[model samples]
Target: MQRANEALQTQVTELTHGKTDHQGSDRHTTTTVVNFQPFSQEIAEEEIPEHVKTLALDSYSGSSDPKEHLVYFNTRMVIAGVNDAVKCKLLPSTFRKSAMTWFTTLPPGSNADFTEFSTRFLSHFSTSRSVQATITAFLTVIQRENESIKSYMTRFNELSVYLEDSVPSVCVAAFKNGLREGRLNGNLKRHQETSMVEIRARARSYILEEEDNRQKQKRDGTTSLKGATHLGPASKFNQAKTNRPGPYQARLSTRPSAPKPLKVVNAAEASKETGTAGMNATCGGTMLNAPVSDILKEATCL
Candidate 1:
């Protein structure tokens, strides 16, 4: 029984190591190969298309959005008519630098399918997901002071395209509120229930009216200036003549007149003999002292 047990142990030892040669000088050794691929054995062994290898795809690094890269990759694969296994094989071609390094670090055969691979890839680079803009972010979209209504609308619409859930009424309100206060703003506000189509029509009409008014003002100014410039010498002469003073008031003295000289009148005084005769006539001595002729002359003088 002891000898049989010894023979069985020797057989087990030879099997554990390797088969010995007939001369016991050489051994037949077996080597085990580990598959380091992240994909299952079936996917790794799958034959890749020659056209797929030649096809140029957009490369991705750690910096850009990982999900976007996957989307683009999947789209290209679908167009190429490749299966999920080919897709898994071709994904590494799109990776570069850090992305390639991350791919190399994945556990061997950890991803059994394309879905599992994509899930793992997204999980690792989850921080790279794009953050969507909220409704409140639209509050910062204001019209510039010098910007025209058309320019403001274009800018507003450009931003609104990114906001998928934006309300039409809120956007309209924002547009109206952002406008600089003027006739256009007042007109828009007066019709609060107006739709976007109506608003555009009104804006178009307002813009056209403004342009027309500006053109009219320019034409009037130009006409007046031309009329003034072309005034003939004869017209100037007529204007000068009209401005002159009339005949009655022409060449009037500007200074005060000198005073008039006073005049004196001379009269002859009564003679002394006449005065004596008059005195004698008044008294009783006048009859004796005066002759009849003298008395008559004196009486006449008196």
Candidate 2:
């Protein structure tokens, strides 16, 4: 009887232990299976915010990658007609975030930002026709943002000053004019002055050439001096013998008489004599009167 009681106790203890272990395993499996779907749903909802949804809805919405999304957001900020000053303040911070995000996602040592994205973005305004339209649209959007034209101009000038290196000619001109008329400070004007100095330096050669030509014509007695040296060397020798004067004496003797007034030659007579249209022919059909080099330089400076 004692042995049988001991066996029964042992059986009860083993069964109890087996039941406890089975219950523990079932609880662990239930926890994992039951909580996973709800947790995953929560995570998915948390990852996508309302702003991101709205951005995705927009025509120019950015990428799914956070870094790319940041760049896209900033680019859309400009396209969406955000104020320039605001954009200037926002862009650098967003750009840093974008770069960081991009770097983190990329493989170590990958070259993601090596491409000049800004250059590609600005290239859309490389021509006059497109530039004018873009500027007009941007200005219109700025005006609608409760900002004055002057304020808009100032901001635009500030935004584009660094970008001037890549901006088109018409766009730069438009920006310059806007700054000149506006709430913008004199920064563009100062740049203009520097550009003008460079232009004048470049055109110096042309100006000097024009001045030299004028001086030469003035000293050469205009058209009248061309045929004055008519005597051949032999005739000059005969005249020297007849006059009994040395070469220097002939020059001195000729200097005493009052100089005769030169005949004012007409255009036709001058062209006929020269077998060309005078200076006009040599100048490639352009009028020599207009200061073309100076005008071109001034236009470029502006």
Using all chains and alpha carbons, the TM-scores for the candidates as numbered come to 0.33, 0.19
Counted clashes in each candidate structure: 0, 0
* TM-score, cand. 1: 0.33
lDDT of model number 1: 0.65
Q: Model 1, which residues run further than 4 Å from truth?
A: 1-35, 128-302
Kindly report which residue pairs in candidate 2 clash with one another.
none
**Each prediction's Cα lDDT score?**
0.65, 0.43
Q: Tens digits of per-residue lDDT for model 2 on 1-302?
A: 99999999999999999999999999998876554321122222333323333443222111223334445656776565544333332332343333434323423222222133333323422332233345564443332222333344455554444334444454445544543232232444455533423433443453455445545544443422222222223344444555686789879877877778666554456667768743442233323343577446445544
Question: What digit string (tens of lDDT, one per residue) describes model 1 on residues 128-188?
Answer: 3222342454577676764556666667766454332334576677677677777788888
Please report the TM-score between candidate 2 and the true structure: 0.19
